[model samples]
Target: MSFTQKFYTADHHFGHALMLSETACARPFASTKEMDECLIDCWNSVVRKDDLVFHLGDFSMGLGDAARVESVFRRLNGRKRLVLGNHDYAKANVIHPTLAGLAWDAPPAAAMETIDEGERVYLSHYAARTWPGQHKGSFHFFGHSHGRLAPFGRSRDVGVDCPDTGYAPRTFKQLVSGMDLEPIVAEEAESFAP
Candidate 1:
């Protein structure tokens, strides 16, 4: 609930007109421009300039070029990092594992591990079956499913497009509050299918 801590978010798909279409995210906006502006405002309203933000991916699309992407980041609040998503690639299926390490505080990684609030954390644009130390209480945060994916064990999706997040950047505690985090084998994970 506090805005002073680190935050996670993704699937902004800024400038991607299709993001608001019914077949896509079905965002409540008349145009992509309106959606983009609203998302930025929501992000800044919660995230402070010094807060760390992990953007799980699809940060930009349909913006046309790197400069536009860079410009968008400029208007955004917080010191940001990226976990590259599928649509975040340059030419080939390239937004995985690692990036050229430019613009961002570090390279845009497909996945990576870090420490958060004294707990181990795994970050990715896609969900993982069993992250390192999950049974030991580590948390895996991801995006790209746009809220369709089911959370397993301690994993969660931080995408803003997800109705749960309400287009705002949320702290890890805020993201997982009230959820069952007890250790469970990945084999017992819930399925989206009936």
Candidate 2:
């Protein structure tokens, strides 16, 4: 399918009841059904049928079966590429068939590095302190933190729960504009380890 733009998002946690609890992401919605529909609407509101989306991870959970998961996946707009999360696994390290059958632009991966419009973008389901090209102007984005993890160096969480992402997919330009983008220097990283 043809695409006009690229967007990034993750951690929708559809059908996952724990996501509504205060100990979890504390989603304001009263129920998973409400959260799911709102997430789908938020995605479709900014994403178009021809837009490409890179979902970092945790797309769905507790949906019972593949058919149910597929039902939700079909409602969102865009051609999707997924970076597998801990929840996406079925067993023996295999992705669920329903996700595999979704006509993804490429095979779902645990991590990926791409050249986008002459810029390098690295993607994963979890954050990293330093990535390939951290000092060469490359950008690294990930999800899975649900906004709990703070931005570190050139990488940051792109999960929907993050305020910067605004509970929806975001473009590279929009994400980068809010980033410091300063090259990581040796001695710049600090650790509390004894």
| Per-candidate RMSD, Å | 4.2, 2.5
lDDT of 2 by residue, 60-173 (tens): 986457777888888999889999988888766888666777677789999988776677999999898778877677889999889999787668888999988767999888
TM-scores, all models, native as reference:
0.86, 0.90
Writing each residue's lDDT as its tens digit, candidate 1 over 1-194 gives: 33556889989988898888899878889997898899999999998877888889888785456566667778998888888888888668665222343357776777878787787889998998777887678899999899998787688888997767989889877888866778665445444224
Candidate 2 backbone clash number: 0
Off by over 4 Å in 1: 1-4, 93-102, 185-194
Clashing pairs in 1: none
Q: Which candidate number maximizes lDDT?
A: 2
